[model samples]
Target: MQFQHPELLYALFLLLIPIFIHLFQLRRFKQVDFTNVAFLKKVTIQTRKSSQLKKWITLLLRLLALACIIIAFAQPFTATKTALNTEKETVLYLDNSYSMQAKGSNGPLLNRSLQDLYNVQLPSEKISWFTNDVTRKNTSLEDFKSELLSVSPSQGQLALSEVLLKANQLFSNAEASDKRLILISDFQQNEAFPEIPDEVTVNAVQLQPVNTNNITIDTAYIASKNGNNMQLKVAVSGSGDVPASVPVSLYKGKTLLAKTAVDLSSEKKNTTVFDIETSGNLKGKLELTDPNLAYDNSLFFSINAPKKIKVLSINEVNSGFLQRLFGQEEFAYTQQTQSNLNYNEIPNQDFIVINGLKDIPASLAVALQSFSKQGGSVLVIPSEKANLSDYNNLLATLGMGRFTEKVSAEKQITQIVFDHPLYENVFEKRVVNFQYPTVNSYYQTNTNATDVLRYEDGNPFIFQKNNTYFLSAPINLENSNFQNSPLIVPTFYNMAQQSLAVPHLYYTIGQQNKFDIAVQLMEDEILKIKDSSSTFIPLQQTKANKVTVTTIEEPATAGTFEIVKDADFIASISYNYNRSESNLQYMDIENWEGANSSASISALFDTIMEANNINSFWKWFVIFALLFLLLELLVLKFFK
Candidate 1:
């Protein structure tokens, strides 16, 4: 037993007041001598004795009542016998990952775990709650209750170590009384569980049944058959002691393509692979037939075949090296004479690499400028035999003008910007080494380009401007020794494929956000706004680069909303990205003692009760005191 407010014991001193009052004598009772002398003596003795007895009875009753009240105010309590006990401020760490949504003994294991938490009854306990995703390091039972009510299943993986570390910090100042941690989860073997703290007593409540079985899709890849083929890898897993066969099926556009059965070892996972030919447009689903764990049993995938890119080049004498660069599948290249330039007939490919356009006609120059403005990439290489004015005009259209500095004969190519995307993964480190031989003075350009492959010269050898980046230094095998190095092929291949291909590919296939729509900003604020109102209402942050708004029940649809706001807009409240409410994975309590781990709900509840125990003791003390006083009075009445 523990007394929360032991200082209240001093209130027993009030009993002294009654004792003093009882001790003080009233005027010596002078018995009237009206009665006979013998009767007078008896009357005197009886009166004195009876009066003394009454005073003693009253003092005893008052003191008993006072003592009971003081003891009650002291707030005494005893600890209940539990498998694990804690007197520290505890935080319950619950897992809310997608995998927790898997079914167990009582339907969804997560739901059953939550029900258990809600049913926990410890009036004298304090509790703080946290999930694998959103955690509150410093929180009270009251605050935890609010968050618990709002907890929803998150789609991300659970980080058990983090929750454990957090739990350790919560009770650092606590004195011992069996500080406890209880984990209530499915206890999946794949989930991480670290060692628990020696000082903290830990227990586990496995939510999963003894023999639950399941099969899941492990991975899916698109492999090229004609262009690209797709491969689907699946694994069957279970908790059963006996081996079982699981059926796996593949579907393409509502049509069943293949079905196969895979045998899984007892308490083990087995993998099976399936291949499909590239149809250029394929949307399909993979299904695994398992009695349990249905969420990961089915997988969806989509594949888009590659399309050919066409380009027109005007290289010097059609160099064999440059011809081979565009010789890959899905690339069609055409070379024309320098005099007969046809811009209208140029195909809409990724880019048009113009080797030397010195004597190009003004009409041709106008056509090239218009092509680039319309989202086309053009690589202009200046040669000693070409016109300069036309090239400068092209540069002017791209927010840059021609160079004013003359190339010095002593100038040499210097540092190269290896960080650029064009050079990324193009060559292995120290695999190939080559140096540029004697180079005739290359023309200088004022174009704001990214100097990717630079020369020893102070000026930029190769640079990029606008949306298009250029590799300016002459790749002519005669001028530079790059051809001798093994990196030449891969370097040119990656640059040609990645540089111009990025813009076109991203614009066509990437997720695009449009700003042209006329979005009505019904009002400037969103906190008190109604759903029926027409407006592009601002929302709070959901993820790294996303925002959302959600409507609740009682007159609205309960769903999430993806919101996009202008950069200038600002607000207070934020949004939540966690969309799934089905997941409720329970963290392992056994190893849940660290700066990151969370204390169990039971532990937190115990702490709160301990604090409230003080007040409860005081209230009980007053009641007991009153009862004792009444008992004393009854005793006196019956004896008298």
Candidate 2:
């Protein structure tokens, strides 16, 4: 037992006032003669003894009542521990990721958690709470109740370690107080459960969904494109027991373009294909009806009008191969000799190839360096029977390694860097034991760059610097047969494709996505990605002919947006939420050792209430005081 106001206990000494009054002689009684001497004396003695006994009983009752009253005012209570003396700080970690859209007993899991947080009673008035993208410190339940009522699912998901770290940072380090972190989440099975700290008491409330079945549109890609038709393939996947087939629809701005059903009866993963018009801009949306998570049900995408890449070749040899590869439909191929080359046309081209030049003019080297700085890509093919001194000087000027001397030994181009971004979608599988291309006579260079293709002896057959690609030997028919090999198509085609880096079918949100738009922006002008009524200006860099746009977390909602420069619409691009949370799998936090886990948030509040174990005795003390006073009144009225 402990007293709330223990100093009031000193008032107990005032009980001595009643004792002094009872023991001291304050009044004198008159002596009287009895009519019968012996009988009178005996009766008087019995009366005096009865009077003394009644006085002693009344005095004891009065003292008991006064002590009870004093103790009641002192506010005594019994507790199991001294927890009341320490201040408590609570930090709530509420998980509102897209995975919480799973259904629980009431409704969606996230909605149920929000309702519980709004209704559950807490011991402290001010608590710190954080969600995936929202945080508030020392806030009242009433103050955040409206915010909780309007909570929505987010695209961000923090791992357990990140949540713990954020929670610990919210606590104050200057004060010595009891810190507790209440983690309310669905506990998705995406990350590991990190160890809890000793100073903080962690109580986890894991919400369980009614079922784990979910179907998601994993991704979409351009399978193939013909004359006027494009084939789009979408990959669908499911968790738990799925249905036989799901209906997938293609819409262009709310107008249905095509409809198809994916067969999921035989396998958990399957693809469905649709063919649409190949030309023009397509603001496309692929949708499927799902009862589980809705974020991944509809995927937005765009297919902008095709922009031909500008390819230029400064050649001294026959240019038939370059013309054949860079067709008139896809590339604007321009061939110019050394004397006829126009330096002003260099800024407008996307890629430049210097092929078999006998001499590198000082003015040409300076022009290529300036073009490379303005985001133009270059590929240098050295010339046989060439001016080695001028070529080495050009290489040195461009920061490419100098060519030492020519080697006559034949070398096979055997290695390919399939992982490089230049070959990103080129190879379906790594090929081995194929007829490797060979170079008869090649120049050996001391270049320090990432080798894209290596010789049999680990020498660089083809290497790439920042924006320049180098072939160690010339690929003319007289010197090498690499131009006739099967690798020539994808190698030359992908290099041009990656040079411009046009947008994909769609990009996932909350990721670093970079692409180029060929539209040139005026000075002091910017590009905006517009979604509905909101517009976001992304991080951009302007080059000579195009603007490079990079987006991470803009236009936060997933949809197809328009890239607008001032008022004119340049093109359409798409963003979608990450499908990582599409699979409705949960972590088993209930069986975690040394954790205070609960499913009901209200129950956790009750547990906190019980943990204190403070049974107040002040009211009981008042009742005891009343009972003692009643006894004193009875003794005074009936003892005589």
Best by TM-score: 2
User: Taking the tens digit of each residue's C-alpha lDDT, what string does model 1 give over 1-640?
Assistant: 6676778777877778877876785767665775488988987898789877876777787787878767876777664543224344445567655556667656665666676667666442465456655757556556655666776665444444555676676555555544545445554444556766767654445555434444455545432334465465655454444347778898875799899877775545676777887655455667776555555566555443454455567765435766777777756677776677565565344467777555656666676666656445566655554456666666665665575544545445545566776667554663224554334556666665566666665567666764354434454554455445444565456545542331110011111211111122333423222223423342321311112233232111211122234443222211122222222233443453442222444554455455344323566668778887887778678755
Off by over 4 Å in 1: 1-20, 29-54, 63-95, 102-108, 117-154, 158-249, 258-280, 286-299, 314-319, 336-338, 345-347, 358-374, 380-466, 483-615, 631-635, 638-640
Error of 2 at 45 (Å): 8.4
lDDT of 2 by residue, 486-548 (tens): 888887777777678888899988889999999887899999999787998999999889898
TM-score of each: 0.57, 0.84
